[model samples]
Target: MISQATIDTVFETARVEEVIGDFVHLKRAGSNFKGLSPFSDERSPSFMVSPAKGIWKDFSSGKGGNSVAFLMEHSHFTYPEAIRFLAKKYNIEIEETEQSDEDKLNTDVRESMYLVSEFAKKYFHDILLNSEEGKAIGLSYFKERGFTSDTIKKFSLGYSPETWDAFTKEALGKGYKMEFLESTGLTIAREDRPFDRFKSRVMFPIQSMSGRVLGFGGRILTNDKKSAKYLNSPESDIYHKSKVLYGIFQAKQSIAKLNNCFLVEGYTDVIQFNQAGIENVVASSGTALTPDQIRLINRLTKNITVLFDGDAAGLRASVRGIDLILEEGMNVKVCAFPDGEDPDSFARKTSYDDLVAYLDTNAKDFIQFKASLLMNDAKNDPVKKADLIRDMVTSISKIPDRIQREIYIQECSRIMDISEQVLTSTLAQLVQKDITEVGKKVKQDQKAFEVVKNESPVQGAKVDVLYRLERKIIEILLLYGNKTEEFEDVFLKTNEDGEIENVIERKEYKVYQRVYLSLQEDEVELANPLFRDIFNDLIQYFLQNENLEIEKYLMHLNSDFAQEVTDILMEDERVVLHNWEGQNIIPKTKSETIGQYVSETILTMRWYLVDKIIDELKNSVSNEPGSDNTESMSMAMDYYKLINSFSKKLGRVMSRYS
Candidate 1:
């Protein structure tokens, strides 16, 4: 229910590239931007952003849309939340109408989960402050751990009363669905009985990157040998433990600001770091680091410092995570506290400057760190030495970037006192073995999925050219929809014998109109639900504001589309050359080269379309000759006209771009 005026203002002021750049590390790739897919685990970048179009496409995932789409995919923001985020980012005020009871009832399932999670978080917070048992147990536990009131509230620390069914009864009394409670793992159900899952436990709300409570991690206060020290919410609709990190939402901005991240092993480690004035730190919640979790950190920063405990067992257990971090093309270093000290204890025991200095002095690149740690055990033992080398090579093989892999190999060889060639050969064999295994997996999947339609022609090639082009065009409109560009509109002219008048001179080239008209002949339908929704919304926007800037239109888009629009407008990585007072960057030779390529590709695609239609007509005529020949011939003429019109439009676009 945000006011249209506010939306318009946000769209006009908020740049898509600037918005998306906050989340995506975009690199310039020709006229667009590229980044690793946020939606999928990808080594190479398949997430593309066209700054010119203001849209992004995750080629790996077959998901394409504008900036709002990117936000929805990356952060899982609801349509309204996305717009509100953009509004806040751009300093635009939101005017929302109160939702009616009927409107509230029409919420989608995903939104319902979000609502339930939010309610649970509030309920937990209220209980922690208002309930006698909660205040004594959860609040006291956090205070003992040196958590200030602000920090406790910031992390949404809470407690469930010792009494069974306390939270469950309250939630059900408030009219929240029991099914969602069970699904969210907030309430456990056994036969005809149900009770609060976190009863008598200090609660730690697990959150998604956008700060939605997905699940909880709870600790038992009693020293019962039979009881597990900590318990986590069972995997639910919103919580996927392997795919989420503990402190991402809170630490993301600081991580980006510092251009580095500290990866710790536990929730308290993260909280302690943040409290101790080191905000760019997160933890895996004591779980082994996953590619998904690693990628999450990678999205925030390129540099990672794994904070390990000094104990040999702790360091050994963390080695696997370091290897995984390196394999993701990240700059990884390792740091260990003094014996008996973990990240939490160390951060609390020392001053910020002391911890910073210690990290700076002790942090070592993964290769040197790993080699030194392993070398100590392999002293004078050839068999152990060989095993260490093989292990190092295997870790090196996991790296996706050839340059990074080679650099690590050189370091490994130098540190391990081995020949570079020997290490290189071993690495190659490991990589080959991995590739073969992957190939085998692919073949097995193919056999299993034989009945499924193979949408990808080459498993990675563009599946639908028309869809791609249309999406690209929409992307451009979303990003640059308001830019004024000259365009020609043809009108017929006739003589004075009551036939027709001379063609009028018009100076109208509304960007939206041009985009609309450009695709009119193609009759392309946007396949993505989000894109389609935005497209229809955009058409309305255009009708209202002939002079609207693409930026201005962005505010009016649904929140999901707003995020996509913002991402597209803000995701471009083209570095504008500064202090170019006298430099002539547009060299004639370079311009000519680009022009030639554009012209050729446009004509090639157009001709391909034309020839395809012609071939289809000929085949149709041959296959059904009995149908009225004149009608068939007329239909063929219409097809020819359609292709001819598209050819002209393509030529125009080519000439304009050139």
Candidate 2:
């Protein structure tokens, strides 16, 4: 619904490097920047950001696009959200066209949920900043907890008024439905009545990476021994507790810069660490860490440092999450606070330098930490010790890198007093198990292929030839469709029905004649999926629009199609920027002359195939009725003439290369 002008502004301002740099740590690689791909797990850099072209290409994933696409891919933002993010970043004012009532009613359900969540976030923020009770209660509490005003505002902390109906009444007054309120977990609906869900609790807005509010965490301030101290929004369309990590949006850039993420357990844990000058920290919000959450962190940084409270129960609760991190092939280190302290308390008491130094000194690899933690419990019990060792080896096996796995195996052996050879043997068994599993998967795939093949007949030779020709046509369209050429027109009269009939005069040459005749005679079409869609679009545009340019040609495409065309058109290293900056624009040899080479090659290939097919047809019919030696000889002679013409065309094509 954003105006076209605003969308254009966003596109112009959101440079690829500027957008991707927010999530990826890119270093200069000549004229571009290179970073590890966020789409895959790899140690080497394969994601290239080209500021010059305002595009990025992930060689590993084969995903290449502009800034908008990077946001969609890395942050999981929808198209509108990506545009809005860029608009906000570039300070573009958005003007939206009003939708009809029916259109509003038919809005996407997931997008509706997103809209409602954003509304609730604004409502809560208004309460905390403007309402007397919210300011006195929530705002004061956050300030007392050492959170600066800017930090509190940035995180969008708020207070839900103690009166049960306060928020429900306001939300209803604003025309928000009770159903949406309840669905978003902002209101609790009872029999014919609704109440604010987080009344009197201090609110923490949980944000997606694109800064949309997915859910909230609220803490009770009063001393009620029976009541739970903290409550989070129930799982909803946008908020999955296991997948959402707190403070990721704020800390993502810092994490990318530092190449490490500090994992903590609560909102205060995150705020306190940031207050203590460690900005690359996020909290799991006391929920058990899941692989989804770990992967989110992995997108920003490969190394994770998990901060655990010193209590044995706390450490035990966090141990399970470490293996999940390991399974993602992430480097994880465990850093426990002093026996009586938590991250929040420790960070508050210790200076930033001292806290950082202590963590640097005490951080232990998962294997070492797990081994040491279990060794006391396993003392003098062979069975317990063996189980502990197996658990350690299993964690080591989850690592993706072979060298890293071996290193962890060595550390596990040294810490547990187990033999390295035993650990290696255990790793071998795990690898063999993996290989067998993969083999089973391959066999399943083969069975699926057989089932599909059995359901349909294989294509005949004629269909196969048509497909190959179609593919070749698409290749030409992608590579040389825009190039212009001059052609000679030939007109002739033919005797039909004992009368001389004149055919219409027209001009055509090898390229257009071949393309036109193929479509006319065989009903063939471009075969490449992307190019086929584009070809149809190009025809439509040409028919409808009289004044057209190459830029306008791209404008006719949707962003997806435009991106595909841009990729195909720009992929070749054909157009090098020459040192002709100070020279005259024209060269003695025009660059467009290159198209003649392509035209010649295409004509040669077409003639060769046609001749081959003609020869086969002639041999088949030689002995049939009415066949004569003269007729057969004439067909052979025609084939030779076609072959000679093709050879001349082939020579012209090769001349360019020479």
How far residue 634's Cα lies from its native spot in candidate 2, in Å, is 3.3
How close to the true structure is residue 510 of candidate 1, measured as C-alpha lDDT? 52
| Per-model TM against the reference | 0.73, 0.81
- Model 1, 347-397: lDDT tens digits are 888999998899999999887888878988999999999999998888888
**Candidate 2 runs further than 4 Å off:** 23-78, 379-383, 434-441, 453-533, 539-597, 608-616, 629-640, 651-658
Score residue 471 of candidate 2 by CA lDDT: 47
Ten contiguous residues with the weakest lDDT in model 2: 573-582
Give the winner by lDDT. Answer: 2
Clashing pairs in 2: none
**What tens-digit string does per-residue lDDT give for candidate 2 at 208-302?**
87677889898999998876899999998878998888999889899988999999999998988888888999999998898888878877888
